[model samples]
Target: FFWGFLAGFLEIVPYVGTTIGGILPVFYMLMVSDTLWQPLAVIGLYILVQQIEGNIISPNIMGPSIKINPMFIILGLFVGGIVWGISGMILALPILAVSKEIFRSFDATEPLSYLMENGLARKKDVFLERFDHEKHRILRLFFEKREEGE
Candidate 1:
């Protein structure tokens, strides 16, 4: 009952909650059980459940509603946790959603909004394209300088 309740409560947290919820029971099993197989079984079950939740369930359910890239969600969680601990993690998604909207509202920041979005249909390699353009410009200047010297 206690493990179930704990796991349910932690499920409110994004990304790492299910993991921490599973760890507690596994630790308890490790200490109390006489046989090693029991604890190992607990670990395997938790791993399977977590994999299902993370990959299949989450992407299907939360992916559309949240509309942020999985990469950005993970990054937000890390930054939020680092800056404000547990509270930060809890608030991260809403904050990101709001910020993405704010970015979308302005024409100048629309590109940032696109980067944060889950959509991949119109994905732009902004950084690489800019870097490649710069590289060609620099090489042209370098050759121009060499020709002038000759």
Candidate 2:
């Protein structure tokens, strides 16, 4: 019951919190029970819950509200984990969301919000813009060389 409440509260933290919530119950079960199957069953239940949450619940909630790339979230989660273990991973998504909101205020930083966007269009725009910039540089270099030769 305590673990359930913790899980409910920390559900706001994204995958890391859900994961911790799921694992803690298993540990609790193991400590209180003699049967190995009890803990194993809890693990299985957690896995099922995780699968459902990932495929269904999260997309429904996070797709609109969080509005960030899942891959980026995973990357942030990993970076947080490396830097400060479970706690960092748990906090990373909300921190990232807040950061995205802050960056949204300025025109210069507006482009960065698209970096976190889940859609391919924004990413394509950024890539195409960079390609155009580089192409212009290369063309300028070639023209300069030709002019020098002439």
Candidate 3:
């Protein structure tokens, strides 16, 4: 039940997060039980609950709050899993969502926020960001060299 609740709570994250959440209890049950049916039953319950959350609960609750496209959520989940393993997968969605909200404020990252919605990132956003960072580094170094000369 706790695992089911956790899975539902993390419904906003794409594919892998929920799966991770759901599997924990099933594994626990499998280890403790002598019979296979109990674990299979837990898996079924998790699946049913997942369907409800996906079709009903999340659309009403998380839709207005996060506003991220499903594709990016999956991408973030995968990236987080790769970098941080299970903990990362669990955390990635909220981290990505918060970052996206922050990114929405800057004109430079506005396109990035849009890209989160559809995964269709424009080259302009990437190039401009890289260019700006490089430009700043060059300018800072130039000023530092001039100050040293003086």
Candidate 4:
């Protein structure tokens, strides 16, 4: 139940959304608990749950649909924190996501095309020469299987 709620809440913001949402529970436990050890325990529990989510859960559940770069998210949080306080930090990445989608629409394509070409779409293309002939062997195996199937 707690995990479910955290997952849903984290879905709203891109990038560090999960981390941002994870902080709330830790702070709440620290603030409400009587003993120092209780807060420490809650923090440990949060880290454990986050590890599980990152390794097993997120890979299977949110594998392809929710893919966002971590750098952008960090920038969002920093800018948002600077601008509008904690709430801004929370909202910045989501707003960027929504705006990015909107800008990608056909109606806004011209301006967005230039922006994307200049900003996000720039990437280094590295060429590598392989010594092993494994790729050809793998292709031949696949072709043989397809031919056999037919």
TM-score of each: 0.55, 0.54, 0.48, 0.41
Q: How should the candidates be ordered by lDDT, best one leading?
A: 1, 2, 3, 4
> Which candidate should be chosen as best, given TM-score against the real structure?
1
Give the C-alpha lDDT of model 1. 0.79
lDDT of 3 by residue, 1-150 (tens): 566578667666667678788888888998999999999998988788778867998688977778777888888989999999988998988998899988778755655676676434445576456545543343454465454556
Order of candidate numbers by TM-score, starting with the best: 1, 2, 3, 4
Q: Residue pairs in steric clash, candidate 3? A: none
Q: Report, for every candidate in turn, its global Cα lDDT versus the true structure.
A: 0.79, 0.77, 0.75, 0.61
| lDDT of model 2 at position 129 | 70
| Model 4 lDDT per residue over 19-138, tens place | 777677777777888878876876787778778877999777853443445566677779999999888987875776676566556432323322322223343231112212344233
lDDT of 4 at 20: 71
Taking the candidates one at a time, how many backbone clashes does each contain?
A: 0, 0, 0, 0
lDDT tens readout by residue for model 2, 1-150:
687688778888756677788888888899999999999998898788778978999789878988888888998899999998988887889988988887677544655566776885756966557544433343454455454556
TM-score of 3: 0.48
Q: Could you give candidate 1's per-residue lDDT for residues 7-74 as a string of tens digits?
A: 87998876678788999998999899999999899888878877897799978997788799878999
In model 2, state the lDDT of residue 145: 47
Better of 1 and 2 by TM-score: 1
